[model samples]
Target: MTSTATTVPAAPGAPAATAASAATGASVAPSARPAPVPLADLVDAGLEVPVLGGRTVRHVNLDLAASAPALTAVAAHVGAVLPYYASVHRGTGYASQASTALLEDARVAVAGRVGARLDDLVVFTRNTTDALNLLASAVPGETVVLDIEHHANLLPWQRRGRRVVVAGPTFGATLDALAAELARRPAALLSVTGASNLTGEVLPLAELADLAHAHGARLAVDAAQLLPHRPVDLAASGIDYLAFSGHKAYAPFGAGALVGRADWLDAAPPHLAGGGAVESVTVDAAEWKTGPERHEAGTPNLIGAVALARALAELERIGEDARRAHEDALAARLHDGLAAQPGVRVLRGFDDLEDRLGIATLELERGSVGLVAAALAAEHGISVRAGRFCAHPFFDRLATRANGLRVSLGAGSSADDVDRFLDALAGLIADGPAFAYDRTPAGWCPRTDDRPRPSFA
Candidate 1:
């Protein structure tokens, strides 16, 4: 299951590749590829917690779709830059110059990683929610979106005169409905998720792009889920805009990007109105800068950008072919194992496994999801997310239950983790949880079961 696309060419203005610049650009002299790290080698793999018999087992984290664990490479890059930290774009000091250069270089690195066009502007924001909000604010006319989108993609456009189209029964039919809706009215943008947060099924981006373009609408993809598993090239895919977060891509939390055309973004008023976003301020008004700086009104997150760039660079160094094969194999194993279970139903949008990433959503017939999830955490030391996964509309429309269990994988997930998760689920299905559970305001919690909470030590 290797991807056929080669690594994208470096963006102009990026540092020239050399022997020492192996992690920043694509032109490292051909050498042996770095060996991939297993899930057990991650920073959180050694975590231990008490289970049913009061015995501790290493925690098995199976929640990659929500927020993936930071990669060791990204952490190292953050640590390396600690000494040179400074206020970017303001100070003329030595560290400031270096940090500023790092921030700008990181923008170029991320843009290149996503195959952004030469004219596209990459604006770093807080997360996918913030990025989409910025785009929503900039959209000139009514926006069209699918009902299956994450809340981040769905909520922002509601106030902007949006038209929501409910998906049809089948995937292809859903696209046809969307195309018909786009035809019904003049639209400024058609926003969609690259992959469903619930089912992990990928959308037909190229086809959707063609449909949007044919209907005089620009396509914006919320790639928070897709970027982790596969390649998303803006130029090649004909995507007008792409929004994704750093945490989902093995970078630390707090940074995301909105990369796309400059026309809409430039024409709209600044997303934030103050400080660095301005060219000069008069008593009555202030002049705004064009491009990304126009919206980034505050001091930028230099460290976050550097860490994200390093993570993207590391992914490139590992090669998509190797990463995809590893994830696909584990996904197939997990899917097969789940299918073999008596009452387990693996929720999916498409018939083919290739249309999905390594994510599984399960609906159990015999046990309560809350009890199963709580028992897995307290009695089995396995972690998974059980909920609507932020797509309330999708769940309300398709799922028999409001919530389900989602097990997602990433670069760090290994055969051991997947096996452990399946074993836990099998045990749960064969026999109910050993402990009683109750749903509270927070979520499901153990009832009268007192186990020492694991410390980060």
Candidate 2:
């Protein structure tokens, strides 16, 4: 199913378009037509996951916090465009030109999805890790990242000897505390997540942004959790930069982006050294390209960009607000249901994990969150996640067991999945490995069993 919206338009001085440009290039595009239809119905109607043994027709996949499944529309769109793919901007050939146009157009498509500025340069990188790492190279101040950030956002700063500060446990208090800290420090940069990886907390974004600006600091949001399920108005949110991964945003390709503040990125040295990033390379010093090209070194992943753009379009058509409300209700169901059980502690210092959708990470007890995750998958067909996720410092602050179980959801998730998962968890902790998970194909599938599949790997 193709999307009806074509929302992006040409800038003030853009040239008129023809059939050829429309076929494969960026031009002043029109707005997307309203899509009364949503992909969720199609996903719900027929979806399948293969296994080595007797395959279950309807398996619960609740690992969306880590990575979400693709919309069928997105998959079909990518499949159709795969054959036309070419080495973008590598040559003067027709295919190369076509690919380059589509690649740039993907930027416009992404901008429409997020309501970003018309001229905002969107650089497509491999994933959230690469995108943020690339952006970090440009930041000119002592960086402030919360202990709540994923390792992807944190490690890059530490490796560079940049000053790092871990924020308070609660989101509201964290910002209040940071205001005073930033006052004492030089003009600094703050990096935070829109929705946290664990606990599914949506940070105090508007309030915190205000505080950051007050302290002469700007905030960069890791929207890896927020972008897919909800609307992220970067301009209104008062964030300086916005970062997110596509795999978490209904497109499971190696693609992600960091958008905003072109100057900081323009001033810093390029993250990767390569051909496309340079404007003109003599045998001596190179004349660097301007705009996003300055940062986006090497041959770009044109197909991944196309796929990500389409995925964002699909989400926009379905209406971000509606998706958030539906998924939020589902997350609440799981939270409340789990809280009723004995020995189960649902940890949330703020309101309902900050109005997040499709993610609910909690601790069953102190010692074996990993074990509980395994048991849930083995005995039943439920697929949830465990371990500290990637937010080591956040988990450390809350004093959770180093590894905790994280049960998440997606656009494809059902109430039945959560219900079955809750039932499975109740049984698993008591009985221990009901199906002998170490021995079965379905039981020991990619992410579950007697042990967890290595997360970092």
Candidate 3:
């Protein structure tokens, strides 16, 4: 998916794009609309099409906002560290010391990537969801969340018995709305997502951070979507704390982190208390170790953290500006192409904003979103997400509250992938209403080779 805008005006005297709608309540036929080139087209051209069924089946993976495929450099970095794997900051063995150094190095690497202070501790957990949970356990007092936040960033507060104030889609006026919300409720922390998990529209992080600080509240961002595509300057952005999953960042590891000030994290009990977290345990009396170790208990997923660090380092090496440009260009291409379609309503930057990520979630005419999604995956071999995308509140304001289809891309994507998705989508829309072929498992269709293929035929 790319940012889309139609350059070609209605062919001379054909009809204004809205003229048909004004005359009749129904939209114009999508088939009559011109096709726009998508980013999938560019990406597919460069990638090696895997051979399946005696023919090359080029995969159009548009789910990168959920998780990107690992880079070659990141894989190599992980392979190098595998031989020296050992417990960090615990064992007296040489491997242990080396591992300890590497773990700290990983912290520094992650800190640098996000523009945090070097001394800041990056406590590793299971994934972004886990990282946010860790923060939830650490922070005390009432939490304020936005309507657009993913559940990982919202539900944790509920579990902690903290009062959570859910705000509406501020849209262009998020900061003002947040400031007013904070004034009404004196908050200790504000948990927010850096971008919408579903729409790929960026939240105003810097502005939000500033607003949170003015009201004497600390802000923590779930950068699950931001880390893979944009440069997350935690310090510069004024975000006191940040969390993102390694797997979602293209590491595909169990490791994730809650990185920020040590005071709040240190004052709170260990999220998962055990071995490395304690200095001395005597049933009743226990002394905890200093720094990130106080939180990371058990053996720790050493390999996972190393891989995640490598992934971030690779992103930094490639340069954030360059990568964003590549993805933004592709997204713009797709957005323009799709926006021209009569009934296609893109769930991103429509009226006010111009810039956005490569990811796009949309609704099509005359079809169930689930059916359309399944058809794209099965018939076209193009993977796109459909439904609420873990964002129910965001959908509540959308024209289609039941569900909306998502199309997201990432660093690994090219133009061909975008094109394939658009091409597949065109066919799916033209087919009219989408109906589940049978009572197969959800997200399943008569497929070639995906996890547990179901027969759509």
Candidate 4:
């Protein structure tokens, strides 16, 4: 179903814009608010790429949900931090002290960004998967989860003996199902995604938190998708724990965080047993430190943390209203345009949901999705994600086929970008791919491919 036909709620404090206005490029009650500026400058804003038939076009990236390109400001911050890169924790040298300060500062900044409580411990990790895995290692008891989760959120809990509740037909029904499971038996934590990575439909955090708390269980949100698109306040929403990745948040230097109350983390053994994690060590026994240092064993991704902090600062400066306004318009246009096509079907988890990110996953009724995705990239210079998206079980239930195409946009996207994608897809649907393609082990590739990779590669 298309979102355009529904009366989706506007971002808080922002005027609503109808699907018609979005399709026709009309302003949303121009007098109601000032016109939005570009959300945030991205590192590769106008990079050119070679398309089929030896033609060049400005690359259009509709795969932000996978791994967003770094913000220009974030890249600059990385350059600034690289000069002082050194080992952290207990180092007396000048560079080490500077790097240590930056890492700790980043912890504070990230915690503040998510409205973390004063007693919360911000543990650094490799990515969202790592963060959730760390939490799974520390959780005191059984966990409850929904079937409509990415594997990172699902498998970790399953390994630790979780109660999996299949999602219901609608979001409300799904909430009820979760409540029923929680009431059936007490769980230590109710782990869920803040938004579905496949459908981009946002879940109500406060409501979920309330349900978990009512059943005497804590809540942990996998905010990998939610944090980058919208704001999250753990304190205000009653969220007990939060996990997210820097890669998805415009800083791709292998860093993420798990922020939550310190009791359980301190109670559990150190995530890794090594130098920085221990206070004192004997040959056979060691005393692990508590708090963040307990889990962070060796050298950390100091530059990555610094870059993430800078990227969050940039997003704050751009303001949430402007970001929401820009993405809302683009998403409406995209969903409405695709739904208008004869063979295209936009995937969604809930029919009654209101808010979503600028992410749309679709399947073609008449053609191979893998082939179409390849054509979009080779012929249109458009980058989108195709396949199971690392959620195979969820995909098997939601899709008729084994895979689908996902087109997602973010801060760097523009009206022109959306229009170009719509036009290109329409053309492809009408005339088929311009060049012949063949299935390869990697995926579908042009039969006689001649595109050249950048020299750096």
> What are the per-model numbers of colliding residue pairs?
0, 9, 30, 0
Estimate, for each residue in 84-184, the C-alpha lDDT of model 2 and write its tens digit.
78877676888778888889899888876775665566778888888889877877777777777888889878755455556654555666667767777
Q: Against the true structure, whose TM-score is highest?
A: 4
Candidate 1 lDDT by residue in tens digits, 1-457: 2212111122223233331242322222221233234632345657787876678888877888998777887887788898999988888999999999999999999999999999999999988999999999999999999888999999999899999999776778888898889888889899999999888888989989999999999999999999978888999999999999998888864899999999999988898898999999999999899999999988888887888788778888777888787777777777766655556677766554357888888887655676677778888888888888899888777778757888988888766677677666665655456565666766666666667754765
- Model 4, 1-457: lDDT tens digits are 2111111121122123333343343422222223233478888888999987888899998889999989998998899888999888778999999998999999999999889999999998999999999999999899998888999999998778899888877989999999889888899999999988899999999999999999999999999999888988999999999999988999888899999999999998888888899889999999889999999998888987888777777777878998889988878777766755546778888888889998898987666777777888999999888898877777788898778989898888877677777766665655567787777677778877888889998
How close is every model to the real structure, measured as TM-score?
0.88, 0.82, 0.84, 0.91
Off by over 4 Å in 1: 1-41, 351-354, 448-450, 454-457
Cα error, residue 169 of model 2, in Å, equals 4.7
Clashes of 4: 0
TM-score of 2: 0.82
Alpha-carbon lDDT of model 3: 0.70
**Whole-model Cα lDDT per candidate?**
0.80, 0.68, 0.70, 0.83
Q: Could you give the C-alpha RMSD of every candidate to the true structure, in order shown?
A: 13.3, 15.6, 7.3, 7.5
Query: Model 2: clashing residue pairs?
Result: 4-33, 5-32, 5-33, 6-30, 6-31, 6-32, 7-31, 7-32, 10-28
Which regions in candidate 3 have their CA more than 4 angstroms from the true location? 1-55, 161-172, 349-351, 399-401, 432-436, 441-444, 447-457
> What does candidate 3's lDDT look like per residue over 392-438, in tens digits?
76566664647788888777776666666665565455443132343
Q: What is the lDDT, from 0 to 100, of the residue 65 in candidate 3?
A: 70
Worst 10 residues of 2 by lDDT: 2-11
